[model samples]
Target: MRQKARDLFEKLGYRKIMMAGMLLTGIILYGFLLDSVQSDTYDIQLFQLSQETIRSEKTVEDPVKTELERQRLTEEVAPSYQFMSEIVDNQTALVASIFGYILEVKAPPEQEEDRLTKEEMIEKLREDLRLLETSDNGLRLTDDMLSSLLSLSEARLLNVQKELNNLLESSLNESIRVEEVARYRTEIEQEIRRNETIPNDIIQAAVTIGRFGIIANEVVNEELTAKQVEQIRNSVEPTRILQGQVLVQEGQVIDREVYRQLELAGMTEERLNYKPLLGLFIFVIIAVGLLFIVISRSKKDDEHKITEMLVVMVATSISLILMKLLSAISNNFDLVISFFFPTALAGMLVCLLVNERAAVYVTIFVSAAAGLMLPSGYSATLQVDVAFYILFGGLTAIYLIDRVGGRGRLLHISLAVAFANALFVAFYLLLGQTQYSWSEIAFYFSAAVVSGLLSGALAIGFLPFFESAFGMLSTMRLIELSNPNHPLLKKILMETPGTYHHSLMVANLADASCEAIGANGLLARVGCYYHDIGKTKYPQFFIENQVNIENPHDRLPPEKSRDIILAHGIQGAQMLKKHKMPKEIIDVAAQHHGTSLLKFFYYKAKETNPDVDENTYRYEGPKPQTKEIAIISIADSLEAAVRSMKEPTSEKIKKLVDSIVEDKLKDGQFEECDISLKELKKVKEVMCDTLNGIFHSRIEYPKETN
Candidate 1:
């Protein structure tokens, strides 16, 4: 049954599987995030004119209106207060501390050699007050408050403290709420003036100190306030509409009270809200439709890489999940925290692992979904600014990752992204009509920088996981394989030193040519390094590795020699597959020769017997199945053919490269791949330039005259 199922899956083809995948993606999106992306379906809102009259189905408590009434009652109830005797005591101590400081400044100790200056005393007193701010006394005195108190005579300062203490005892015996502190302060000033024994010189200063010391000691009693609220909520009966109540007449405006009644009676147009459900359907269609078009039009090579589709689908799902999580966080903060989302992570992953061009379109689909995950509930209107910001940032990431060369250049890419993200955020914030506070502007700016850095960090972090799980070949993986120390690369260098240098030359040629025609140059370069791995097993048999030895093939029949040459291509493929190398590298190794006639051995065989067949002297090949391999095939032959030339010149090399390309074209080696004639022309030009440079002649030193 399992084998049958696997066979059926293949028979259904990529198009059908893609359709099913798209459908599943849509369903998952709708199932999880429908509330965020659904539209304003019913068109019902407060204060709108009703086009049709709505009647109550049955009489019930109008919860909306009743709740409003209860809230009004709760608001009207004055907050109860509790006067604390301990607050009065603390204030008395703090006031006493101020007078003590004043008396100490008035008369320093006789035993001290140096008397403290008034300025120093005042400074000390000020520092003491600041320290007191942290204590239970919670006293905070200003410079004016401290200096004025210290300026008074020691005797007068003591009298002022006594007066303040008595006044607090008399006044705070009653309640003093924050709102009525002013009224009580005025009464205390009158009481102080009536005391004739107190000197008049410090009266104004004492009044200032008295007023400064006073605070609202009677704090609100939360227990009493909550009890009062509960009573109001319980006492207020729910408002009700009659069974036959006309909640709204035709063309009647939905005022607050009338709208509440209509809503309570389930007569609002949203009672049967189907538009959100329908909107979800349309939303899914648009998102999935974009993916379908993008994947369908990609390189023909992608049709076989079904894993690429699955990887992209999973990446898309991850992006949606990130948006949903960000929405949840944003709702809590009531801020658009999506500004900090790592929008470029998915784009960078797809660009490196899959097609860079397709990554841009996939990102657009993700960004469109991002706009749907808005702050507003369920009536999702796409936030044009957010969508635009995400789309541009994602596109920038794809461009940088695709075009930029070295790992060291990544920091430069991150900095570039940071600048773009910050600029985009600032531009949008400034351009919008709503006046955002400087703090809000700072928040968004910081989030943008963080967003850019996070994209790089997250892309780096998740790259290894995705590559391991999917066994996908990325540019980084290709670079790693290109290292000289890799076991397979070292094997060729040790066992087949001549073939190793030949492979390196082919790599240089293939890299330049593939890049000229907008193909994956890195893949071609790395593939070329391992393309001749089988020659390691029979290093001495091939001409390039025949150092200081007689040609072994000279001792064998032409038929036997052809078989040895033919076995190398097949053996290299098996060896690479055994080492678990990427399929793309294996393809290049297996198809670089492309079943072309082996003229050297075939002509030699033809001299011996007229009946010798041409088919017997060819490499068994699947042909070049991609542009990279096709270019490699051409470069492989061109490098060998040019190296064998005697006293090669630039003009001779160009003609030679052109002839090699035409020979491959005539033999139909490129028929299985998608390489075009125009691209081939560019490839020929690149090969000619590279070959000429490699074989350029230099002026010889004047023959050792000594």
Candidate 2:
């Protein structure tokens, strides 16, 4: 029944199968993405007191509260200050110079005629002091003040100038800002009054002049102050509402804070948003389109192309559906179960059933789909971390399984996958700075490990089904079929020993030749094993099976003999189909001889009857349509031809193999297949090498030994 169904699928052809796979993939993906896209929003007016209080549906960070707390902390930090000692030094020097000038003018000079009058000296001093008033120092001593200092006797003037300079220097020594200059001036005034050596009027005038010299030396450091505020803001921990935390009771009225929390938790209804669904549709289209383009451009046969499309679609769909199911369960229990989704299962299956490149492409598409389907904290869009997690896990599985030899290596691959999952989970937790307790960390780590092991286990479980359903000639299946214990192989060995030996020789030649030309050597060898199974039904009719008997064809007419010989191809294909073998191997049995004429039988008929039809001796064939089948055809013929050589020297064997391949080429047997001339030449050379090794000269043993 299964064989009949497989045959029916083969008859449906590639285009229909590919379309069905595409439609099924789109449906599965769209259903999951639609569920994710529907945001759960509450229908409540902004700022309006609610009749019924709304609690958070899921745990989320209160962005509004977190921001407010950070802002308040930042405002509480004090502005930083920097001291500028240079301003104090410049102002004090100006005061000392003004006082010294006054004393110098009051003193008697050796050249009395050159000395200026008091008023003239005062005018000159006013000019020098004019520039000081306009300076940043803010020093503006009046002309009257200068005249008052000059009017005093020279000794009293020096004493008053010394007193004023001492007061200004002491006041300017401390760090004073622009706002505190008045207080420093007041302190200096009291100090000057304490000095009774000069008159009270001199002390008052001196105090006023010293006050003008004082300026703010300390300034606000804007850059440093901003940095300090930023640090304070960052130090304040973010206030998060834990998952499943209730914001308000059912009967409690909705306040401003409760309303904001509902919005943050995505409980505020604003109608169902379909934008995510639309985006997901576009995403699916692009992913499917890319796969289509790659498959169309590749050199695979129609069956293989169909198989590839089916595997890709089915694997991606299964992975995403699993993610969605896990997400739904996690949402119910408030668990972060997205990490435990076996995202790498699809990638491992793809790598096993298809090529590595296709597996990589499938991994990327599956990761992106997972990001959308998985529950991200409060956002409806794709989660970047989930995407990274899936990508890391999937690629790791691909890399590990790519080097695997068979199903036996899957356990090791699973272990490697677990390590990769754990590493990525640790990295993600560390990057997000998530504070998980030892128990929580262990739970997450264990989940990740389970995800990896489950991915491998699921892949192993599904592999055989896919290989059987899609008729995929996977390496594992090929290896299984190549075993001698297979029923058909056992039958061939028991019933037709000569044909069995011939099939083995053909398998060896085909395997070596296919490998040399970069074809599927295993498929070729396995196909060759069952290529002549039809001979077992009529053991004595074929030459290989007629070991001690006369030629069966000599007793029958040439036309009847040709019919018996040509029936093997079709009969062998039917027998394989009965056993439900892969389509590729069955194709080898059906199309190995192609439509090439049986020249010996045709010539024998022509000699007996002058007008024998040539088509009667030709085998019915669709021709070899793949490189593997084409190489098998050539290898099968060459093996039989080389075995029949009476004098099987290296030179004779080489010549026979070359002649057979050339004759098949002339008959256009390889025209329909994709075997290039260069590959064919390599195949010929490999065959000659293998044949030479088998038929190489051996040393003669000494007669005396008998």
Candidate 3:
């Protein structure tokens, strides 16, 4: 029954987990908030009633403005007169501002013309310079003497000529006049002289050129003034625009006022009011049913549906309860605050335990639940405002956080949550003209901490419950157990050092293999670490993992040797169960060896006793059921088998890993599971790489040093 439940959970989707969390969170948060709200309401109501009673006693003795005071009290409770409703609505409006339709800017006409003309001028100058430089170089100006002489200014050139004349007079016995050669040299010098004729048009044009232009048009909302709209338009405009060009399209918010637009999008007090209980119930049903569909619809197997639903629902419920406890505690304290509490908490979890896409939907569910569970002026109006905060907070958290592995980085995660919530609340307050103080900022910072801590706390507290209730073991718990400091792991290291070292090597190989195949690398690595833990019972039975071995297995009969080898899987599974390890780990340890033949033991038995049955030498059966387990099983064998090679080369390691994988495949070891052939090939490649690393050459110990 437990195995069945686990299998179902393994197949459950993000939606189911989220729905369960939402429902649980809603129930707890709602129960608590409703109680708190009711308690406060009762106090306020009792106070008002007491005042009325006092006035009645006064009126019975003598008449005054007692009736007027009663009327005033009634007015205070009126729906339109309630101040909190407006605050919540305004908050919603501010949150709505975070979303706006983006208009991509097109190229402006003036910028385009300017850019083209500049390019044309640069091209022309480049061509002209190339021709003059090329001609000057071809006239033997490559020589340093001639090149240096040509580089001088016109006056400097004449000084050089005078110097050359003096040199010729000093060196010669008689006067020499080569007029043609001198004339040619003079003409060449004039050609090489700088031309100052070109205008500074290029620099002028480059400086004057404008890149683009835009005309923003506020189309959807009219609450903003024409001047405000013009400001938005001007802000969006590209620096240069062609004459009569419409830079902005009609009915567009040229400069976006997100808060006002969000208000216009029905986040106002009038639009928020609804039958609170009915709205909450209906929304929950739609959300739950939709979530169920996303998670369960993809599967066609009838045998698994009931079990899957139960596990998913149970896992989700535990998560939700944790979220509620954290939220309730945070809300109760003046030190705790966040605009979107449960939503952010759920976002990080969805990323850790599930995929990002699932986290998104889960966040939505939590947001809606939060709306139903927060305090409001009019119960109906309050729900809507709360929903906005919840949705925006959840979506924003997930959107901002894209990757998952920063789980232990609490401070960093808290800062992220704080900034998000601050922006959310600040935007609302500023746009809605909501009042705030330094205390509010402090509250927001506290809320961010609460949000991040809640996520971590929930994962830690609920992990065990979910593992038990749903039989769904997670990667997190596996990693915790794989640590060398763990009691079981430490025992293995101290008592069975060879096995422990072997396990670590196998873990590295399996981890890399699983990642290459797009499987859970951590799960693979951790599973590998514990896959042979059964050998700890009789440490000297296995060769590589044995220390001071006197060939215990060799001394035993072939049949006995096979039995001992096969018994390790069962032994490992029993040990894990006794230690209360998660079922996933137990499966990895028990099933990793599968029912493959113990070739050495079987052949030895056959040689000694011709009538011996090969079946008696086989392992108890249950093949790899997932990619992580499958990769670990292969890694365990490959790591052991690779060490047998005397001079292991890259090519030999590749063949060895491939042969092991092919043998496993041919024997149908992966038939019952979802391990794909492509993944298997990747695993083979990783094993080869790891083997090379392990066997890489290092300096041998020197006898002199010893």
Candidate 4:
């Protein structure tokens, strides 16, 4: 059944399969967001009697009441005051200086000049006081008050100035409004009256002058007042509805606040509120569109493109479904289990199966989907916070797991992800200014820790299913196949030890070349290990497995020898298929030799017969179809040629490796693959370096001492 499905998928092609997968993902997400159990705004009416008792499913603060209380608290805060003592001092100085100037003009030095008449002097005093009044000094004095001050004699005026300065100094000590200035002036007059040393006339003059100078020095501090109001608002606690608390009882009339709460809880009615669902649909469209664009732009073969899209879509769907399931659990059990959802599972799996950049996109999509799947009572911004939590957890997992080479490293990655999860949760709590108790903090922290660990656990658990179902060549899977204890590897080790050693050398050479050319070294190495498995069937016939015996090919005809040599590629591929190895490994076994002619056998057969079919001496070849396989082919031939060298030198190794690669290039052995000339050059350089190291001249040990 699976094979039939795979054939159908192949026929449909990658684009069609991608479209189908996206469509299915959208349907599943839509179903999860708008489940049958959820209510819509159109289902319930305003001011209606409740038919059923409604209770708070989760502990949530009523934003409306909370805001109202905050506003009330802010309004109740008093305006702030700022003291300006300099105003009092400056005004007193101006009053004293004005009086002193008047006294000086009235009594000039006795013999200095001709004395002015009383009317002229009074006019001059009025003019001078007018100048003082109209000047930039902030004083509000009447002309009559200035005249009253000018009428006083020097002793009385001095007494009045002294009394007024003292009054103004004490009165303008604190912040006073414009309305309170008159009150302080009256208080100053009372203080003057309480002192009998000054006459009533002088006292009246002092009070009038002091009143004019006592301007409203203390004013409202706008900035400080605003800050105080904001602080008060912040201090107001949010009104909360505890879980399972009754909102409206059966037969109870729903008020405006109750109706709002019902709407917030998504319990109002079943009428379509297409806004959220529409938003979700648009989100899915954008996400899937971006994913499609990214996948389309990626450089991969048709089969790989199909497999990658399938894995991404399936992994994303599983993540969203998990979020929905956890959301449902949270709602049904009245628990905040969404925080514990293994949000990073899909992203980690994607990273393992695909690349990190694709995994990053998957993380973004899954995070947004998880946000949409949160409880309806959550505000839009809180939902965004939930998205952030999932994103951080998933990204942390991907970064920590990207370099992971074996399954044993998953535990360390899981612990790191858990730490990241906990850190994000702590940051969220701090950013939100949530007032959680120690126990509550511990609970959430533990949930985050569990979420991280479970993400890794779930990723590890689901990886095999994706790899097997999609035939993905993951590093972990390759590492497992590279193990020498595997059945096929063990068979080759015991049956044909020479061939095993040759395979090991080929694996090392292929791995190095692949790495040098930025290809899949692990896949190349593993493929090399199994590439020559067919040699095990007729170990003695193969030159490597002769074990010091006479050459078996010497007794056979050149045509039979060519057949035996060509059969290994096909037989090895068949044997790999029988054992259910990945197709990539099987291709290496089959196509490594390509269609290159067997020069030795073809030339040998032509020596005896005038007409020999050259095609019969060629390999049954599909050619190397990928960079890894192409490198394997070169590495396999290069290793065999170099190993057979007598007293191989660095220059000889380099020449031989270059010659073999150039021949393959000229013969079109690499034509079907994407290996470039630049990569080929790099492969040759790496081969020469590796072969030189392997077959380097060793110093002769001191045999005489032994």
Which candidate number has the best TM-score?
A: 2
TM per candidate: 0.60, 0.70, 0.55, 0.67
Quote the positional error of residue 58 for candidate 2 in Å.
Answer: 12
Off by over 4 Å in 4: 1-253, 256-278, 380-382, 402-409, 423-446, 697-706
Clashing pairs in 3: 97-258, 212-238, 213-238, 214-237, 214-238, 216-254, 217-252, 337-447
Candidate 2, 319-351: lDDT as tens digits: 877886778787575447788888689888988
Give lDDT tens digits, candidate 3, residues 441-521.
Answer: 666656545655555555556556656664554545655676677888888887778888888888899889877876778
Residue 193, model 3: lDDT of 36
Indicate whether candidate 1 or candidate 3 has the larger TM-score.
Answer: 1
Best by lDDT: 2
lDDT of each: 0.79, 0.80, 0.54, 0.80
Q: State the lDDT at 1 in candidate 2.
A: 51
Q: Could you give me the TM-score of model 3 versus the true structure? A: 0.55
Cα displacement (angstroms), candidate 1, residue 360, comes to 2.1
Instruction: Report model 4's TM-score to 2 decimal places.
Output: 0.67
